[model samples]
Target: MPDNARRPGTDSTDRVDRTDRAALRADCASCFGLCCVALTLTRSADFAINKEAGKPCRNLQEDFRCGIHTDLRTQGFPGCTVYDCFGAGQKVSRETFDGQDWRQAPQTAQQMFQVFPVMRQLHELLWYLTEALSLDAAHPLHGEIRRGLDETDRLTRLPADAFTDLDVAAHRDDVAGLLLRTSELVRATVPRRKKRDHRGADLIGARLKGADLRGADLRGAYLIAADLTGADLRLADLIGADFRDAQLSGADLTGSLFLTQAQLNAARGDAATKLPSSLSRPTHWDR
Candidate 1:
């Protein structure tokens, strides 16, 4: 193996930018592991040991190597596998800084790590735009998606030095608005909505357990405080939709389109229910 590992499992999770899956995997391999050095997490289900931002884990060996990667789950570090670097991480580490190791820069590592999250947000927008273009039903939103993609691409080229000053949450909200439009266009033909557009509708406190929501368009819809236990969400386009405070227990979300683990993590769900393979049930939901 090369000093940099490139296993099939090693490909950066770029589903947010679901274009050219193979190229996206290469984009991940091209990264210098900004995630490993930039992020900090306390010991928990996801991470076996506490790691501070800018401080490399004891298991992270020299030359960007992980000492127990193959045995991460057994070694109690399965959380690493669940995290996605979105392609910006390695680029900022290598391309932005010209391959200067964070360990060497020392003073700049924290700022670089901080920027990793910002870049991930931009890349996620790029991912959403790319996927929107791939949808034949969403032709009406093509121009908008292109515009968003162009802007997000520019975000990727920002100076790493400026990342520390970025307001990423606000930027994410802006792009999220357009992504919502694209989702509506894509699901316009789905039969579930009837004449009622659920766009931005509040479905909170509804009794929807075991409902078949297949092929539904749920862009930015508020599902808070809803009981969705056992609801079938297969093939539902759920971009920017709120699942917060929703009971997804026994909800069948298999094959649901465009749903990320981050979205699921922020929601409440049950263990007997199915979820995207990438996410585990929240501890609160396991009870």
Candidate 2:
């Protein structure tokens, strides 16, 4: 169960089910600025300069807020604006470390840094699992999805040492298997080819405007800066597709499988971008 979760075995526990899902969204207000300190950033199109892991970002304030929060994209930190930890930062700060601050508790800094990433992977899995359970086409796999969600949620509550020793990759592999099955089950309902496999394709800067990509398996495909304007992406499997800077104006993503909020945030969408009811239009999208 999550922080305020009630008894889980009751028929009337649907309220907690929604809260459990909401907990996976990034909650910066409850975090300790973990991402700014624990993740490495290199000077590139996204970041202004280089910063190593375990070092606080120069723009991180004493109150754990970004110094230039509002102007991150204009200040060459567009990467920060797209990154989401899936609420792992607050879980580590409030649950694992019991509200300890790395700046004040210098002795706890190293362990906290190590645990943050581990918790992040677990939370990301939780995000996928929660999404899987909501798919009506995946009704057959709801039992397995719930079990996976519960297990992943429990793992997020582990202590610092346990997190440091956790085999997150192995866990991710197991969850991936489940998600793949869920994707297959859901996509089968759409009238596309049995296998629209485009996994890991180098589609960067591809001019795919108004293409019919419905029910395509684009898992992990490099779609960076691809022109997908007005594409028919209904029921497409976009589990790990990189949509950074991709043009999605007038694209239809209704019933898309495994699409995440982070991916949508990275892409450029407009008022004409048709999204599933589960996902909202990116705030930066042209209205």
Using lDDT, give the best candidate's number. 2
Q: Which parts of model 1 have CA positions greater than 4 angstroms off?
A: 1-29, 192-211, 217-234, 240-256, 260-287
Clashing pairs in 1: 16-127, 17-127, 31-90, 32-90, 230-250
Against the true structure, candidate 2 reaches a TM-score of: 0.91
Q: For residues 30-77, what per-residue lDDT tens digits would candidate 2 score against the true structure?
A: 889999999999999989989999999999999999999988888999
**lDDT tens digits, residue span 32-128, model 1:** 5666667887898668888888777888766677778667767887667556555566657665666676677777677777777777777666656
- Worst 10-residue stretch by lDDT in candidate 1? 1-10
Flag regions of model 2 displaced more than 4 Å: 1-20, 192-195
The TM-scores of all predictions, comma-separated, are 0.67, 0.91
**Model 2 clash tally, residue pairs:** 0
CA lDDT of each prediction against the hidden true structure: 0.66, 0.84
